[model samples]
Target: MDSEKPREIRIGNAERTTALEALGEHYTIGRLDNAEYSERVDAVTAARTRSELSELFIDLPEPTPFGPGDGSAALTPAARAASAPARIPDRREKVVRTLNLFAGGGTVLVFLLLLALGVPMAWLVFILLPMAYGAIRIWAGPGDVDASGIDSAEQQRRRDVESRRRKELGY
Candidate 1:
């Protein structure tokens, strides 16, 4: 009996790009050093077949361009979501968001009231200031810790205090 051989699939630029991105992640997490990363990147760029790209990641971990079945690219959606970092909004973020909502609504109401009362357009500045202030506060972010100015210990202390305050206030 004659057996049929599977065809070797050639990779495209998209596959090469995916391989580079995966290699970048591995390098960022310190899995590959500078020399090894450079070598793998060169190989990925020059690689023609899916098997060539797959071989580059054989020594590495998951999140590779090639999967177990037929060199399929990328993680499953569930796996991608699971790997992503969770960003839980803290108490200060919650407060800022709430205040922004109120500020926006109040600004609109005042603007309409001024317009109905035949006030000069210049008076709109008064309605706009609170909104501007809210925008600035939101842009500045949480005030509990100054990431650049504070030492690690002080920053930790501030975070602890903020956490305690949030717990006490039921936030």
Candidate 2:
């Protein structure tokens, strides 16, 4: 009856996707180099059985997609939050986004108004100014200063100082 032989379980798309994500995370963290990562990725895509997928992570550490009792599931919400790095919002990006929205909306409104007034098509060229300004701002990338001319570094420094003071005062 071949009772000693273990059943071969087949894997599906969901398992493949989870394995791929785990592999990607490992690659991102430098656990796998470009060539090794590419080879493993191709192997993962071709893997059809659970045993085949398990072979890919044999050299890696924990956090395998096929395994149960991974450490991440044991972390408390507060511990997880504390473990994550804090992100400081960039005011320059926000300002540029606002500028883009204003430019687009202004261009559409002006075009509609000019159309309603039966103005010549040549006047439509004026709408290009706001769009051009928006394009320039985007092309410039997130600069050091925001629309208010405030230096982002200075703002961040001031915020750090304030936070330190508050902590020192036990506030």
Best-performing candidate as measured by TM-score: 2
**Candidate lDDT (C-alpha), each:** 0.65, 0.65
Please provide the root mean square deviation of candidate 1 (C-alpha atoms, Å): 14.6
**lDDT by residue for model 1 (1-171), tens:** 436875679988788877877776655544565588778877887899988898887655566886555333345657544443344666666677777786767667777787888888946656576867667777866555332333356545545543453344333
How large is the C-alpha RMSD of every model relative to the true structure?
14.6, 16.4
Model 1, runs deviating above 4 Å? 1-4, 68-171
Give the alpha carbon lDDT tens digit for every residue of 86-143 in model 2: 4454766766777778676767777778788888894654667676776778776767
In candidate 1, which residue pairs clash?
Answer: none
Candidate 1, after superposition: displacement of residue 27 in Å?
0.5
Which 10 consecutive positions of candidate 2 have the poorest summed lDDT? 162-171
